[model samples]
Target chain A: MTDTPSQLPAHDEASIRVDLQLVADQIKADSRVLDVGCGDGMLLAHLRDTKHVDGRGLELSMARVSSAVREGLAVIQGDLEADLKHYPADAFDYVILSQTLQATHNPKEVLEGLLRLGTHAVVSFPNFGHWKVRLALLLTGRMPSTPTLPESWYDTENIHLCTIKDFLSLVDELGVTIEAGFALDGNGQKRSYKATGWLANLFSEQALFVLRH
Target chain B: MSVLDTSSDNALAPRLTLEGPLVLQSGVSLSPVTIAYQTYGTLNAEKSNAILVCHALTGDQYVAGAHPVSGRDGWWHHVVGPGKVIDTDRYFVIGTNVLGGCMGSTGPKEINPETERPYGLLFPVITIRDMVQAQARLLDQLGIEKLFCVTGGSMGALQTLEWAHRFPERVTAAVPIAGSYRHSAQNIAFDEVGRQAIMADPEWRQGNYLEEGTVPTRGLAVARMAAHITYLSEPALQRKFGRRLQDRENLTYGFDADFQVESYLRHQGSTFVDRFDANSYLYISRAMDYFDLAEENGGNLADAFKDTPVRFCLISISSDWLFPTSESRAIVHALNANAAKVSFVEVESDKGHDAFLLDEPEFHDTLKGFLDGAARTVGLDDGAQGESA
Candidate 1:
């Protein structure tokens, strides 16, 4: 009975971004999920339609929140840093944070909040130690910029950008168990390098992880 | 933009009178409560398709058709027709003249069975909770076990929130647009000024104007004129009618309404007095002022909604200073604290508080989407489009 096309585009299984696809592959079907920075709810919608997951989202932008809600996804307009403490412990089976951890003011605190709120956590972030980034910083003596991390350092939202090695070190510091990990290349294809090896840190453009408390 | 008209000519509608005495939040008991309501569309056999639409301070029960009194179209006619966003073709819409309203409801204008005269100031002071309680009673009489949704704007939003807080089991989804958990100090101050204007009029006769054979026309008009200014943003006012002269070449060099804004306010005030009771304004505004959801739930707004099953969608206008987007955000934080399923939208608009009643496509579209999604979750099949009546 609706007359207008929804402001939010419907997400299909094939169209979901590779990082999100990797994150979705780790989550059990029909599990309760909370997407911490669900931009327009692309992953949540795919999970709801494909796996029948009970998904909810928390987004900061009002425009994205409205788009997500209009697409029939329940999304609260809120920031990850301030709003994560509100959910009770073990409220969801999986809490997903996709490519938004570095943008947060306190990545450590937000990550801890994620583990506390869900039984398992799925996280993805752009790697800051790739060869091209090193080349830009070492050869030019300036801040690095790659296709994945395109924004200039002065105007970038990624204040706490981390390499794969740095992220694994934080995971070790938190004493959380890593269920699985993936190193993705520039084309969003999984690379052959081991996620924990230094080669992955120097070659891969992005990293995805499945962790549990 | 048309002037604000709160009057109703008391067109024919169904009225229900409860048998027992309904207690008030102020520790006063009122007997033989009567609620005037109008229904559009048709109720499904399971009766889960009913949506209770609460009206704002000056609104009546006529929701999607011509008004009985002003002969104007319903306030939300754009959103509640057969093929509209609310879609009378698919849902049963019920609108009620609030408990302390003037449009054929039990209010100051209604006669007290105890004294056989108009209640006037003697009518028991009511609160937002009381209005919701009365509406609940009317639903009980109608055999509606649960409502598909409860929604409103401004004062009506107050009642909608109260419904979700007090009767969560009865409401499946709740939408409170351009509303707050409680009235702010600035809003309370504005209400005070409007009240003082009505009481200052000698013809008011101390809230017994009906018995005195007089009406507080000037005082009420002045109050309406003053309150109307808060409903619009400065930019909207400027765009619609700036300092431009009212049908003249230049200033008249006198106190006459040389400005179009002044003339518009005067017309808004004058017409408002024709159909509204000054005392009802006082009672309704007072109810809004007393509404604090946190205070009602042991001083924690989240506690009021803890473990509640009702889903929520909160909408706020970008330029509504009276009830700004910050208020809706605060409520969202509380709902999130309780892990309640909640959705929020701050519609970009310069139209201010009245945007909820206007033809804001974004607002209407978001509301429809939320309802459509909620309907699916509740197992409301599209086949259940009740026969329109």
Candidate 2:
């Protein structure tokens, strides 16, 4: 028995507004969505209001879950590493893990868990191979602190940091279907489909993949 | 305010009052209580829309209805409202202010019919399990055979865990949020501090402050202020009030609330006193401090769930110093060791103990996904017309 209240830091709510509409477009109208790492429920709120989709989320922060629930979204307070087994197989149409896969102890299992929960799983993360990140790593020989990985190495949540190729290998090894992939600029713009070559691989700031198993 | 049909002669309906005798652990009793409860939607033909929601220590039973005293939205209004998580449109949601709540629930308020005064220190101590027993009696009186879900958090989460253990088949699914079987030493220490703050008050006359028209408001307020700090993280508080001065440009140089944090805490303390009774706070916290679920069943936490059959969606917070992710993992590990149908999630945030009350979008998605899937797996869609609300 949980409900939504307005006790969270207002900064969380403000950051979600920019990505709200695109988040809505990402999920199908009638499909079920399980959003792992849902922050203050901006996307879930959009889904419920614009689409008839049912949304569920798992967040590590009680305050964020508290905010999401206040907005009338169903969310559980949990850590992704130990709790995916509680959900039955093929429970939803889409399982979305965005911007959070990098911070996990085991990103592969989380991705697998997502694929197990939904027919299609959307996984997005910052591409460590981006030219700027690469240049920093190459020049300093220490971890880079881009806008995505803003914290110091010792405190950063980029524990299982990997490149686009590493994620592709994980997908291939898991035998999951690669339904789609997107390359995005630093401005959050989706790049042309033909830009999968050397330039795109080295320059793109973010990577998105839709997988099915 | 709910539509309590005064015209109907339905005496069997549960009455909302601030007076009663609540049975305790040793078969003793406590009197003079207040219970702020809310009933949502309708109980169906079989009369089984009775889902009782238990709340954490700081929570009252303002689930979906406006609180009579707080003038704020119900704590779980988002999850229990129309088309929301609990979905009142399809089910009846019944949450009561637990036995020791300072809300409208009976606490140290009723005049001891013997002394013609409040029960005060005469109130017997209780446990999370004892709280469940009281709720069980209330459910029985309301004609509810089984609950679709027994749900709660922190102290309330302990009760949810106890319900599944005590009345296994009676609960369809249990959702315990940011809770642990045993109150850890750290959490117990915090509770002790709050209790000491109350007892240390000049007005607290050895738990006999009734006749003097003196209430231990200062001590209780300090306790609340301290507890409020634990409920939030350093990051959240820093982001909120920070080191900035409140209402002024610079330090007052005096011992006043020169900092924004002090002012914020002062506000929390003052508001808390207006609604809660000091004595009730002592008793409830003491009960929580004494809770040790594993100790009740040998030394193993898993052994407590060995013979039980309850689906669990146990939740924990990342930054909560009260019941940390490790505690939730311990429960998940035990349930896993017992091979119970359980799912766990550690929502990453700096919100601390109060995370369960905030809006983390992923939490809503996770809960909706888990409950919906559990509903389908548990046959809530078939034959059971009024099991959930």
Candidate 3:
């Protein structure tokens, strides 16, 4: 029933999604972190409980924002595209945009804004070049509906979806420093391939990058 | 001015008369300033658990008890009782009647000691800042070095903002619910209509209705009726009244409260007239119109909260066209610009601006969460026992 993990009442490590747990794992304790499109603040709350990070959130949906704030997480009801500029440069130690990059109206602009908002930016997105997605598209000659891209093209909000290689090229074009990159398997647990390699783009279902500018 | 404190929780007499003139933002001063207030819960030993709740435009000092004038449960009784969302059992809660209010405070209703008459039109126009200043002095008299939180809805929210802005060090957290940093043009226009309704009454006698011993019930009722519509949404009105007729089934063919909505508004107006003063309404309405946080900070709302240490939680109702969610969004943007710790929740409610006063579970949950989060940061131990007074 819940999109993100339900971390309220008490922190349950098992309920947290793999990608969100990965994002939480990278953040340091007591550092200011802003999670863009942080739905229900599961990751923020997790960080607050485990790392004791000073966490904040920006979510577009009022429902999600209310859920986050109802848990005492500092969350604002706003889009990262419009609201990110209001936050001063380096306002946060880390700005996380996980599983929401493709859904943003302008991914490039949002990435730039996120980079400007924090000393480091952690981003994760579903890879459109995964073998299952490519095979489905090639065999059916229709938009792929893999596990990551579950919804039909007409129904999905991932308007700016891109592959791992595409994302790396944009990162290069932006001249941002990539602190680290990972290519996760379809389950979002095993990091077997390097995000910079074409093999990773073709095989992995998701990609994560820790960037700085 | 005599400061009378029967120390009892009676709504009529608990008050504090400041020793000096209260300098106001209008470059005028109010002498013999008396603040009618009520307190609930015990002040902790460290005095760090004090919370100041500023009341709305017509709201009095009775925040969590039977109101003397209305004889009804307090406006915020649903939220501020012991073990409730605000938990009066833990925090020392204080609610004060504003400076330009009729509720035992220094206002047009009170006699002017110098003239031996009601201040009426002679009373200097008070601003939201003036109300906050009076509240600050009240805090000083109570020996509270800093407030754990200052919160309110509507006009009270404006006072909360002024407190956070003017005395950031004195406030650890602030929650401004269903409010804006400044009054919008439409809001000011609605307030003007209310004022004009009061003034148009022959019984008003140009703000001297008190001296004439004639209450401007009709005009004040009309004003309340008009303003009351703004507090509820179109859907709420549609759901509550719609085209449903009151008492009779068919139209009466005259403007004698044929519709249920009309009857409701009329009842709201007449009842408000019984409890409120026309001059105080005018004064408080004018004060809200004059409140502009951005204007005071040289056109940048962010400047008003520059480097402010206070954590803020702003709650806006979805259908509140009076103080729309956009207004709260603007304030949130400004707070974000300063990197100030802030939370903004636009609650889904068709109840409109009055939802803050109503029992909305989301609003209560958001408030409780924010306060709990802030209390943790402020080092207020929930487990500790409050000292008995």
Highest TM-score model number:
3
lDDT for B347 in candidate 3 is 89
For each candidate, what is the lDDT? 0.86, 0.72, 0.87
RMSD after Cα superposition, model 3: 3.5
Which of 1 and 3 is ahead in lDDT?
3
Between candidates 1 and 2, the lDDT winner:
1
Per residue, candidate 1 scores C-alpha lDDT tens digits across A24-143 of 888899899999888788789989888999888988777788889898788878878877887888989999998888888888988899999998999888889889999999999989
User: Higher-TM-score candidate among 1 and 2?
Assistant: 1
In the range B1-389, model 2's lDDT, one tens digit per residue, is 11211213322124444335666676776443334456787776665445677887867777766765677888877677777777676566778777766554545654556777666777667677667776776676667888877887788788898898889888878888888888989888988899999999989888877656777889988999999998999899999877888888888789999898998899899888777777878888988888887888798887888746777887777798888888887777667555455666676778888888777765666666566656665455534444433
Better of 2 and 3 by DockQ: 3
- Ranking of predictions according to lDDT: 3, 1, 2
Worst 10 residues of 3 chain B by lDDT: B1-10
Q: List clashing residue pairs in candidate 3.
A: none
Q: Fraction of the real A/B interface contacts present in each candidate?
A: 0.70, 0.06, 0.88
Give the poorly placed runs of model 3, Cα more than 4 Å off. A1-15, A192-197, B1-11, B385-389
- Tens digit per residue, CA lDDT, model 3, B1-389: 11222223455778889879999898987899999989989888888888999899889889998987678999999899898999888888999989989888898878888898889999999999999999899889879989999999999899999999999999999999999999999999999999999999999999998788788999999999999999999999999988999999798789898999989999998788878888999999999999999999999999999999999999999999999999999999999998888999988999989999999998999999999989987778685344633
Give the per-residue Cα lDDT of candidate 1 at A53: 91
What CAPRI-style quality would you assign to candidate 1?
medium
Estimate, for each residue in B275-318, the C-alpha lDDT of model 1 and write its tens digit: 78899998998999999999888888989898888899999999
How does candidate 3 fare on TM-score? 0.95
List the lowest-lDDT window of 10 residues for candidate 2 chain B. B1-10
Best by lDDT: 3
